[model samples]
Target chain A: MRSFLSSRWGKLAIGVVLVGFAAMLPLLNIHIPGVLPGPTYTPGALSVLAYAMLIAALALSYHLIFGVAGMLSFGHAMFFAAGAYGLGILLNLLAPSGMPPEAVFLVAIVLTLVVALVLGNLVGALALRVTGISFAMVTLAFAQAANVMIRRNTGDLTGGEEGVRLEASLVPEALVGVVNTRNLYWLALGILVLVYLACVWIERSRLGHVVAAARENELRVTVLGLRPYTVRLFVFGAAAVLAAVAGIGFMLLQSSATPRISTADFTLTLLVIVVLGGVGYRWGAIVGGIVYTILDQRLAELASSSWIAELPPVLHIPLSEPLFILGMLFVLVVMFAPGGIVGISHRLTKGRGGKKDAAEPAVLQDLEA
Target chain B: MSTVLLLLITGVGLGALYFLVASGLSLIYGLMGVLNFAHGSFLTLSGFLGWEVGRRVGDGTWLGLVVGMLVGLVAGALVAAITELVFIRRLYNRHIEQVLVTVGLGLASVALFEGIWGSDPIQISVPGWLRETTEILGSHIPNDRWLLIGAAVVVLALIVLFLQRTSYGLVIRAGVENRTMVTALGIDVRRAFTIVFAIGGAAAGLGGVLASVYFGTVSAHQGTSLLIYAFIVTVIGGLGSLSGAAIASVLVAVIQQFANYYWGIGDLAIVLALAVVVLVRPTGLMGKVKH
Candidate 1:
């Protein structure tokens, strides 16, 4: 534990500081003037914060698979949704009305993780048989298929197009006074910290090195006598669990699970977050999630306003607020900052020591050279 | 049995449409190793163009097709050129970057279409001659379906002939086999890429025309919905192999039609069926890459 803290204490310290800041955000919101005069302590903002953290967690999971394992899964959302619905089903069946909302939420997270493990095994088993673009396509196919199935078949439990709503009992009474949003935000922050620590721990573990090596060259790992497939499957499962936990956080915040959870928009947004934050770099997902959520919320507000809608026909581009901005950002990032925000930060901080930043520089050099 | 036959016919028609769209995607992927995610957007845009042309040209089906194809060709060239200059030029060797930039372009195209066309789904009527249904083997099939199938066959034959008989096709094939070798031999590979990209775009545009006629509706979201299936078809048939993509298109279409017919659940079963196939055959049936 001492060695772990000393080696990467910077990341852990940052995580603590971020969580502390997040905890204070709700308190700060109360003091801010002219924000919105409803509740001095709003649950909605907390819910949004929770959802953002959940997204960050999912993005981080994708980073592990894409960055460390070198597996570009277009369908990782499959696991995420599955894990969420898995919890949704359990809560609906078991808790019904007796269990507290917080307990139900906790139970859901566990159930989701288990479901992810099973799904990870199945998908990984099949995906490991392939490499490169083929693997990506296969994963995408599975995710798309799963999305369709979930949206169609389990309508009764999932609430179909209407979405499954949480019973009032599912929310903790303790949270009722605090405003459900604040409770959720705190909960999300707690989960995010735990998950981030887990990811960091995994990154520093021996298995993590094996996974990274497998990403570098599967054949070389195979020659080294390690079962690259097993390493990939384990990491994929772990990543799925992380994503599922995030999904649970999302459900708690939204108080429901809709077919929109599986929409192309959601998948695309997640991809944007991952790319915007930088694919593999540590803390990239968290940074990306914050930027994306803030932009999205602000853009929606701007688009809905009367002044923007009243603009001249030729000069006005409708729905050009968030999506256009995001699209342009994506293009610019791919063209210039291929490493993403976190990647750029790493480079800046590394300065002369950046020679140790191995694989990414080599990949970028290949692009530039 | 009648239902089965009906499904089969309908499947073949849809498959033909998918073939028109996916052929370009497969070709582009083969030569350039870049998946043109915006292919579906091109199709949707062309469909809208066809609708506009039909409305303006007093309901002439041939004129609509001509205008749609012309617009598609121009749009295709523009998109290909822009993508080449902006994204593809930077991501020549990086597969992930290629995927990311194309996806970004796809999103931008979708947003642009939404901005122009609004968020609603627009219905595009078929021409008078193509509106009637014909009875074949005790099953009623739409005339437009038959026309689309015929068009697909013609397109397929033309593509085969062009690839087999033409010098440019030979060069493309050679380039696909080995880009470095072709470039080393002094062929302007960039020019070849531009042509390939344009051709791919044209195919997508033509597909839009067919889709508008068949679905009777066009929407900004249509491109994304169709893209997944097209990607699946290309992957299942083997990426970069025209024959494989064509065959896979038919297979996917037939399966989807049957699933929709018998299962009656929706598009999900068809997607699941495709996933099953992928799980079993990661490299697809005709993929050159060994899994």
Candidate 2:
């Protein structure tokens, strides 16, 4: 029974349920039969769903490094930004002609992967030398360096502070039109599903066990006659590429790459998402992503909307800033709900017959043993 | 020769700021194994506060410098106390939770500064004596670097003296080596932590005042950037080693100055320092080898 619950089918079943709900969210505005009104859908809601998916995909990639491998990086933004700006640079350089949007995307992705591969190898090599807090700080330092280089040196390619706009003509008509954003919505959804499955597979794999072992104690892993550095190097490179893949989706969703993508604040946002969802939980990424997007959208609305804007100065000082509110939420959630919503639910179901196997992530369970 | 000398002075001066930033961080790590991610926010907050104080004391007297430093230290100490008492003390063994909390606080503080300061950079002017240039090796350079270097060294020396010469310092050193033993000795470890945090805060505030004065401007958002530098220096200096921080700061600054001179890119120098320190000497130059 336990084996079956941990099997591929079980995970896939979970995925299907989630995807179904996600797909249905924007299509299910209705009246509950003679009782009450149901969810109201909007294109705006669809777009937000799309964004949440991208954030989930990105957060999952971070989980592989931070949660699975125990490497807390303060600069995951570098890879995300790399993936994003890599495409923008390529499209701009190869302008006025393209075989097709598909071809351009493929070629650009290939280039970005190569860039991700090299940068990942370099950063991972340096970063892997230090462990714990030092490693986190080093990643941040490199990230800042990357941000500066992108902002100052690549003015022609990146548009400096002004930010570079991806030329729309670079992609095919069906894939990207200013008004018709359904293509992006579909693209983000499909890619998010695929990447999510990849994350699940990683969590259940032997390599995942090895990564988990390394996270717990490298010296112990070494005594067991396994090469920990090779494991760290491989996971780091894969995580970097995975983050870049999400970055590609991000650029496509926005149809442009900006300096904002590379900021440390963005990485902090990703960290908050993972921590707030469920640090090691496979599906926590999606849950956290949605929660973050909704809170972000609502708070930002409250801060900028007419009522708050018109409030008196003394009364208006504290509550109107969306970022301040988000920051407070981050602190509250991490402090109060460290296990995230998933963990909270698990606690609530303590009295009932709980799905124990599903609750414990495979990697974490192995590490514990 | 003069250019090299001047560059060396500037590097040392730049490094002094790094030292100040890393002092509180290193001390915190030494006594308690927590890395304050919001250390730079303390610096930023203090810088803005110090700038306002300096502005108020527009007489350009030594009193202005004294007031600015005092204001920065007090504000930084207050904020640090709140953070330690209200937030950090609760999560003692959980380093990862502390990271997230501090990072959140870091962002919140930056946003708060933005709300108050309105995204504009504030300019700072030092006393005339501090700003006056002097001829050194036939090169004319402002005395601001000297003041920065002087102030940083003095603060670091005072901290070393306090730790070495005082009972509290002895307790902190003992605590760093083994907290259990320190706790067994009945030295309320938590209160000691608060004191350390306050000291760290004051040091960060001092860094803010010195940094803004050296750069001639302070921005609400500079904390995030400065935090990166301080973290790197602390890591490369080997966690909890004050001397390591000072040396690493100078090494980082000199490399940056040289990198700028040759490649017209200074940030790359710091990146290179990180790479070298990580790959070649992960324990840092002065750091003892440890697991």
Judged by DockQ, which candidate is best? 2
lDDT of 2 by residue, A110-181 (tens): 998899989988898888777777788788888888898888845467778877676677666776754445
Listed in order, the DockQ scores are 0.50, 0.51
User: For residues B39-156, what per-residue lDDT tens digits would candidate 2 score against the true structure?
Assistant: 9899999988888887788645678878888899999999998899999888776777777889889877788777778778876667887777799878777788888788888888
Global Cα RMSD, each model: 3.6, 3.8
- Writing each residue's lDDT as its tens digit, candidate 1 over B1-291 gives 767788889899999888988888888888877777778777877777767766677554667666765665566556666667667876777766887788887887788788888879987655677777788888888888887788788878987887889878887888777777888998877777777877777777777777877877788887788888888899889888899988999998998887777767546665565566677776677876321
TM-score of chain A of 1: 0.85
**Which residue pairs in model 2 clash with each other?**
none
Please, what are the lDDT tens digits per residue for candidate 1 over residues A315-359?
Answer: 457455568768878878877887788878777756755424623
Candidate 2 segments exceeding 4 Å error:
A1-11, A24-43, A96-102, A309-315, A357-369, B59-61, B129-131, B184-186, B289-291
Model 1 Cα displacement at B69 (Å)? 3.9
* Residue-level lDDT for B269 in candidate 2: 78
How far in Å is the alpha carbon of A110 misplaced in model 2? 2.0
Q: What is the lDDT of residue B121 in candidate 2?
A: 85
